[model samples]
Target: MTDSRRSSISSIKSDVKSDIESPELPLDQKHFGNTLDQKAQAQSKEQPSEETPSTIPNGGLVAWLQVLSGFMCFMSAWGMVNGFGVFQDFYSSTLIPDVSNSDISWIGSIQAFLLCSATVFAGPIYDHGHPRLLVMFGSVLVVFGMMMTSLCSEYWQLMLAQGLCVGFGAGCLFLPSIAIIPSYFTTKKAVAMGIAASGSSFGGVIFPIIFRRLEPRIGFGWATRAIGFISLTSLLIPCFCIKARAFPKTRRKLLDFAAFKEPAYALFSLASFVGFVGLYVPFFYISTYAKDVSGLEDTLSFYMLPIMSAGSIAGRIIPGLVADKVGALNVLGVCNLCASILGFCWIAIHHTAGGLIVWALLYGALSGAFVSLQPTTVASIT
Candidate 1:
């Protein structure tokens, strides 16, 4: 009986060994019973691999073209927005003469506000890899709004045409202009941004001069139409030239409320909110202020906005250079402090064009620095 039991156990062990060594079985040395070689081959076939480069191509023709495109975006969006002082004057005197200065101020304020506020929606759309589409649509809205503004004699019409339409359009263009640069650059980011931001300063100078120069010859309606044509031409560069380097693999929220939980982000956001509220006050009102308080002629008062914008061109570029060295946040802090002081100093410059000019130039420089460095500063902390 013992002999028969031993023979039966041996036969069962032999059967188990054969099953383990069988060629048809899926099990292998790999974990979870995966056949190592076959699994690897299957993965290779299913999803092709891409090698990530070690370094960003910080300086190249393509990168610089992006910068140029960003520059033109700023020129068309913020440049036109900054030049609203011209409109503020025009609307008060010629178009909507019955409206109070406070009511007229709302038009420019809304334009500036929506230019920034629309980014909440724009940023998410931009992230999903549709930059050219957004820019093309924005360009159309901007030109259309400007043309519509030309024909508007009433307050509500101007608000719809310029404030809501142009502001939302500018918002669409603004995020992609600044956001794409960081993907292409690392060390030279601040300077690149500064250069791109200086486009607004240039626009600030050119738009006012354009409106001021042509308004008399062409009349307000034609003058505005001419400005619209110029905007259409300028906006085309961004629509064609700008391209993004990378896109996120996963989706993100339109508003990243989690970022606000960090103290630095919260404070910085609050400070920016407070700072910008008053910053554009000078840009929008400086011309009107010059006319009211400084007794400057209408022609001379209009030039103040352009001069301020011109100073900002230097402000944007130079601060960016300095920021890359000393750190963007540090430079931004100094600029903000100086800008605050300059804001108060505006009160003291009464009845002198030269004083107002100097004030405007200094204020413009400091404000421009703040504008250019702001994004860089946020990038560092975040």
Candidate 2:
């Protein structure tokens, strides 16, 4: 099946290349062919086009603006997810204290699942041209989800509001951000992506502090509303600024399994799936772990998130710079290895505050590094 798929993709690429090189076509077709040829020649002179791909745009003002838009989109969408620790703690203790950790875990797991899985369809949609509508719809869904979540009390209600609705909204918003970046940066792609991806870290830093402060005075409902307001603001900036530059007018199939034909991409995608499986387990469980194992005070357990977020800030920024220099795959490999080791270390720290703190710092750092580098790794493989 894999070989047949590869052959199909290769045949498609060859046909496209032949069409671009053909001479008996119309004037417009000939002009497009010439443009494609120049692009191919330029790609060959510098690096492997297969590795870099044509989706990347050379850096420019509009390109950087798109990156800025992507940053805002990421910050709002993923930042909310990062801030889940706050929500998890609140809900588990106040509304659903009797709920088992494993059961409550599904709320976050579903959110993360939807957020990641949404990309499968969202990518092709962006390629088809309607990023503006997709983002607008996403923003509306997210705001609505938060507003509705404020009124819910049951487990299913929370899951519907926080897990599925917010997750679906985030998926809609975030897919465009990831897919659109490749449209904007070719040479400075890594650096540009690094800067944009920092939005999540920035959100990590800001949302926790904001939610922590609000939870005391406003209560969970209003605290969430406050966070929702922040998300609203971040999402709006991108809706106005981001755009596709000379995008192709081609139709996109809903599913493009052809992407898996690339062995490197397939491997990286598999690794990504493995890495994400363990990823949210820590994010969701860390606070409970702190409270349960370390016997830490509630306030201290809460503070662990900010500490993790703090390390993540550094983790997101530095590895991005390094990925640009060394190579994204190498950085991702190391980050995953570090995360696996840290997970084991976390398992051992079942009864100590210091050990929990150490785990938080290590896991936080690795998480940032992993997220930041993954895009670059995808860029490298594609």
Candidate 3:
């Protein structure tokens, strides 16, 4: 780089540096350096930098760390929530035996509902740059709620502790991880989400088996406490590492109900709402259904959720790469259709363990794909 060329580029300022990458000026003594300097000086005055900081370090150590934190966050939040089927099964038989099946199901239902919906509110807060505190607070509620669950024997007590407290904590902690992801990635957002969301798939695979193995050995209270301790450990990294980058100023409206004005967004929201209606149906009822109608033994019935979740591991992974190539909405549409078809087929698999296992595999993969792709699709749209 010649002195003249360097002087031309450096004189413009930080905004110019951000808006354009200055070319390496040649050191040729004759034509090249002087000509480039004249052009750079003229171009600098013509184009004004608009104060947009190009801070998206798309691939770097910090960015990968963000992805790592997101993985742990998803594991702790949605992955933890995915284990609710185990709790539902356990609670119905032991802690709250008198409670109606429908009533017991509500605990998991509400937890799943809150785990996703709270994101609507938490997202806005995250855009404002307070993820660490929000996560820490949520971690406390979740761990404390778990500790409290060990003492609760009544239906209402369990409802408030496990359903509300744990659910609320999970909900609050969930969005920041997902919401921060787009800030660091653009072209590979779907794949990053797939990897991060796979945490939940693993959670689903592990937590249920733990609950089943632990419950008989340690009883409900201590088993739940053990799970809580695990959650505490899973949450520590995300609580410290997840940070938002490149979001707009916080003065923007928190809840933009006006986004419904866009027909595409409105329909997308409706589709998501419709999807959620059935999303938890299988996870919440697998054990109960296996026990009640499939006539499976208690030990076998408990494995249904674990099997479904294991299938979901693939669901979370493969569709992401596919979405990256063909488009997120395309993959989501296909998976949602598969899920709908599998859901209808679910009615045919009664009293046969083989049939139930096949259904679990198909539905679990479809559901996992849907869950993993939805966030990427939302960000991709418009």
Candidate 4:
């Protein structure tokens, strides 16, 4: 009649059926079998499908705190990488002045490359229930890398410290930061991820400004150490606050070679590769371009990357809200197209400081949307 009564009756029927089908036994053994059945039923209720409404908190203090922790991860990891433009400018003109721009660019390139490539290993590790371990280890590497970069005076040293060390450390942080959000909130995944991803934009803006203002006064080494100290402080938040929810029984593999056989996976991978190749070109060289072509003052030239990064903060947030309604994949596609068009438009902005600023802001917004939506889209299809 009532719900509880019906459940009890159904459970009883399930036990009786099980006992009848199972091998005949004494009364004590039958009672033990029924107890085991009840325990199994309880376990099943506790571990419901991810899509089940009761399983996902969707909104709560704990869930939102996870978002905050993820935000910190984005800031310390990708944020530092995003600010490599400042380093690029410094390395080309001041630090190792003899190195060609192409050679100097490799430091940032390797850093970015490792940030993505390390995920192949990090993802499987995270799924194996070592999130806190990964975050802690990554935090150490990032702070350590920045500290090492501060002491470096040569190209090879810079590459090892800033490029390999920081990049690999960030790769460790990036996967767990993005992957854990889906476990807490299914309905709000896009918005939550957007908020978390905006940390990089904030980091992007803050790191460049810190470097720009402090580098001249304190010198590059101390300025970089200050950045490292800031990263250490910010990373502590994620290290403590993030709580990894246990996923369903599906096991994660280090590499799913069969994933490439699917058209969607193959196409998405290709698109991401192409998008990234063009994306950082503007971010890395915008300051140098402004100085050489528009003859802007060094102070004004250095601010270009910060301006672009500042613009991305909004782009990172607004698109997620939109994607929650329209779809992450659709929003990502549109943003990619817009970003590409703006990349071509860079050729025409060499004449005016005002033009370059406007272009940077617009491009930042579109590219930010693309970056924020990328993981959300992948989570959806997978």
Evaluated with TM-score, which candidate comes out highest?
Answer: 4
List per-prediction Cα lDDT, in the order shown. Answer: 0.87, 0.79, 0.82, 0.89
Task: Tell me the spans in candidate 3 whose CA falls farther than 4 Å from its real position.
Answer: 1-55
Sliding window of 10 residues with minimal summed lDDT for model 3: 46-55
Model 2: CA > 4 A from native: 1-60, 246-250, 350-352
Q: Write the per-residue lDDT of candidate 1 for residues 196-277, one digit (tens) a residue.
A: 9999999899988998899889898899998899989998899999998776655479886777898998899999999888
Between candidates 1 and 3, the one scoring higher on lDDT is: 1
Query: Cα RMSD (Å) between model 3 and the true structure?
Result: 10.7
Error of 1 at 252 (Å): 0.8
* Candidate with better TM-score, 1 vs 3: 1
User: Compared with the true structure, what per-residue lDDT tens digits does model 3 show for residues 134-186?
Assistant: 79988998889889988899988888988888888888887777777777776
lDDT of 2 by residue, 289-334 (tens): 6787778998888888877866776777777778777887888788
Could you give candidate 4's per-residue lDDT for residues 1-382 as a string of tens digits? 8999999999999999998898578999999989999999997866645556578889899999989988999998889877889999989998999999989999988998999999888877876778988898899999999999999999999999999999999998898888888788877989999999999999999999998899889999999999999989988988898788774466567785777888887888888988788678778898998998889998899899999999899899999999999999999989888888888888988888899999999998999987789988987776
Question: Candidate 1 at residue 107, lDDT?
Answer: 83
Task: State the weakest 10-residue window (summed lDDT) of model 1.
Answer: 46-55
Cα error of candidate 3 at position 372, Å: 1.2
